[model samples]
Target chain A: MNKIFFFLGKGGVGKTTLSASLAYYLREKNKTVYWASIDPAHNIYDLLSLPASPKVQKIEAGLWVEEIDVDRYLRRFLEHIQEKAQKVYQYLQILNLDKMFKVIKYTPAMEEYACLYALKEVFKKHEDKDYLIIDTPPTGLMLRIFSLPFVTELWLKELRHWREEILKRRQIVAHIKHVDFGPGAQLEFSKDKVFNELNAQQKDMQYLKDVFTNPKKTFLILVINPDKLSLLEGKRIVETLNKFGIPIKIVLLNKTGHSMELKELNFFNDLPQKKIPLFEGPFPKQVLLKIASLWVEDAYL
Target chain B: MVLKQIKDFLSQFGQGFKEASIDQIQRELEEMENAFALLICGSLSGMPAPPAFLSLCLLPYMERELKIMFSKTIFLDDKLAVWSDLVEL
Candidate 1:
């Protein structure tokens, strides 16, 4: 399994820049790196000065970059839903669900779930890569995504239990009738479509939850500025992660000016903090490369 | 004639048991399905729902239960929607 690294922070706090630098640093160590961003703003491509494309483009020999297009991702996801629905309920073909899905685009939490689905797709698609660097959405949205797997797993477990009960009842009826309730049983619930779907979903959710909570396999790197507001947001994220039991590998403090003293930040006192000095102009490859070199030397947690 | 009378009596008794158990089982299954629907798509029923995307993902499996959930009306005494049905729809 690949080691997953997530760059999380408040907006405009240099997450994309740091992600790019980290990816470069990892690639320099001869590791195959896949750097993907789900940020709607597509700042990763801008940071790399690469032309935007939906497909993964190779930035260097071992480094690949891609911006996940959530619209395309959601469309495919809906298509998958439609296909499964039509297969399970043959009458679904007449429902015009394709048009109905257009309305789902505006639903709450759709984007975040879609992003999660897309991230899973990306990881599955590039299984050969050794390292995966993710530049996630802004802090608020990112935290919501972090909390999603646990909530979804809980729901899946409850659903699976109900499905199992229904199947047990069907089995009991089959026993009373002394009928071979194969796929051709009167209720045909032994080969239950719903039960099968719930079973598959349960397994998928379990795997995702394991992936998220495993510290050795996943690292959530929180990025913050030296300012008060950014540190406060970072503190909130750390608290949330701590609640979720997600390991905080490192807290990156970006854009620290010469005058700011790291010793004064009490909130980050318990966590391992890495401070990146504020730069003069727009972040260029050379500047990012220099930071990448320094990062390798600093022994990132 | 005596044997036939005894056989008919036993068949009727067996039929009653079968029908009663089937009814009980159907009711239990329906209740379980309804609770499952509420858990999955509670937003439509006015509860705090999870992600809509997840609900949609589970929609294919819940087609029948979803039908029941949407069709059932909350009566005034139903406690589920305590304030609802106060005004005529």
Candidate 2:
């Protein structure tokens, strides 16, 4: 099993910085680590001072980084649909099937589904890597991404009904044309392959859900700046995650001044979790190393 | 056509409602309608409909409408207007 770590919180709470630092720290331990950002409003490249690309550029001896190319993922998903449609069309002598494929490729939840597909691919291919750290999007979209399995399952049920109706219509059309309907003709109309693929994808999602919900395999660190609004938002995040049965292992109080006392931390009394104090500063490599040391101590010890 | 789509969408929920208490179904439909209204009004007003807004806009309307009828209400977003089959959903 691969060790997956997600650094998530509201925007501008040093998630990217923390994720980058962790990746660096893990690399120093001679562990293979890949750090990627999934936020649309990305600054991982800027933070790392690297160009935007899909290739995992070597940041250090054991550390690698990449930003997810959503457009590339979308294109690949569309290509997969086109390829499947072409296979059917070549065998069945059907023309203009690309239009339907295009429509399906652009449906609601399609982009999210494509992203999930990419995740599955990443998990499979990067099994050799010791750690996979992801800097996710802001709370709302991140929640949607994590809860995608439930939404996709609901949509799949409706789609299965739609597929059956399409099959019935196709059968009627075949009858009217006086075509010789042979065995396995129903396979053309049956989106069972697609459904099966979706099921497989769901399994991958379940794996992630397990990783997210499991305390040992995964750790969710909610990063927050020391401010009233940010603290309230952090509280809401914890509450919402609890409602959805997501286990929040740690709360990261980022950008705090030296005046704050860790012993006097009463803001998160409701949460039965550890609060790690990360002081605010220029955030140099040494500072990040200090943060990583804290993380290793908190997580491992 | 829009009306037909609304009717179709309602019918899907109707099947689910068979197992649900009448009050629960009515409340759920009203909640759905409220969500729809908020999406429309917020989008029109150039404001993003946050999660709290969904609950705030829909919950009261649902509670009030549960007293009237078991009718399911549907609102179409402008973005979904192009889908011919969506009218039935």
Candidate 3:
């Protein structure tokens, strides 16, 4: 079973650095690890001194890394719909829906969907790896992506119910009219394309929801600076994830001042905190590996 | 010409009779379709839309419902447009 570690917090909080460190640390432990940067602004390649490429590259014996091309994911997501739409909606050609395919990239929550698409692709492709370290975007976008599955799953359930009702009414209308609406007329859930699509989407959403909220499989690590603004965002992240039943396993207080107390921040008190002292960096591979070793030793991973 | 007119009248009458046989249920079915479309493509009506990635897949199966939706909206200015007949068209 591949365990996933997601590193996220407010912007400029060293998420990429910390996630890269963890990926390195895990690889050192002889675990096969895939490091994915889901952030729109990627830093893993530059930080790792590896040439920047969206394609996954093997940096060493056991590590694979990619800065996910998020827009490509968005394109793929839309293209699947456009392809299906062109096929199933052959009679609707006059509506000129090609514009819709181009325009839907600007849809609300589209960035989150793209990020989720990237994450899902990683999960499907890298299931054989031992550990998957996800380097995520900032607080707002990450929260939406995290909540997308749970919220949409609930909506899908409602859609399924309504679809059943619609199908039953179709049966009634068909019977009363002595008309054959055909086997695919949605008289049954099994033969209905809409219903089956709804079910498949719901199942995918539920799978993601379960994996996100499941502690044993996923470690939700929050990295925050010891600043007031970052802590405020961190508090909201914790509250929102709690609302969705995703428990944070650890808090990495990166670039901390001399000494800070979790007791001072009540929301972060329950979480296991690893205080990392501020370090000046022009971090080479050796320096980064050293930092990873230090953080790994006390993080209780 | 007289015979053709009678044929048209009988065709309209037969269509009306078929509709009258299940008028209430027929209306309920229409309502169901509109509801399904609103839920699936709520963005069209300024309603909170479902996730586009998921809903787009359902659009291929929504020709009937979507036509009902558009017929109403496209004729919103015409109060006597008889949108139900438009649905038949």
Q: What DockQ does every candidate get?
A: 0.34, 0.02, 0.36
List where candidate 3 sits over 4 angstroms from the true fold: A180-184, A258-264, A297-301, B1-21, B72-89
Model 2 chain A poorest ten-residue lDDT run: A178-187
Best by DockQ: 3
Q: Rate the local accuracy (lDDT) of all candidates.
A: 0.76, 0.60, 0.81
Q: Which scores greater on DockQ, model 1 or model 2? A: 1
Pairs clashing within candidate 3: none
Better of 1 and 3 by lDDT: 3
DockQ of candidate 1 relative to the true structure: 0.34
Question: Candidate 1 vs candidate 3: which has greater TM-score?
Answer: 3
For residue A177, model 2's alpha carbon misses the true position, in angstroms, by: 19
Which pairs clash in model 1?
Answer: none
Candidate 1 lDDT over residue span A47-146, tens digit each: 7666799888997898889998988888888888878777766754667776777887878788888787887778788889998999998888888887
* All candidates: TM-score: 0.85, 0.61, 0.87
Better of 1 and 3 by DockQ: 3
Tell me the tens digit of each residue's lDDT in model 3 across A1-301.
7799999799988888788778777877898999888888888888877779979999989999999999998988778777877776676658677787778888888889888878887898999999899988888999999999987887898899988888888887877676665333567778888889898888788888878988888998898888878888999999999999999988888898844654436778788888777767666656667767656763445
Error of 3 at A190 (Å): 1.3
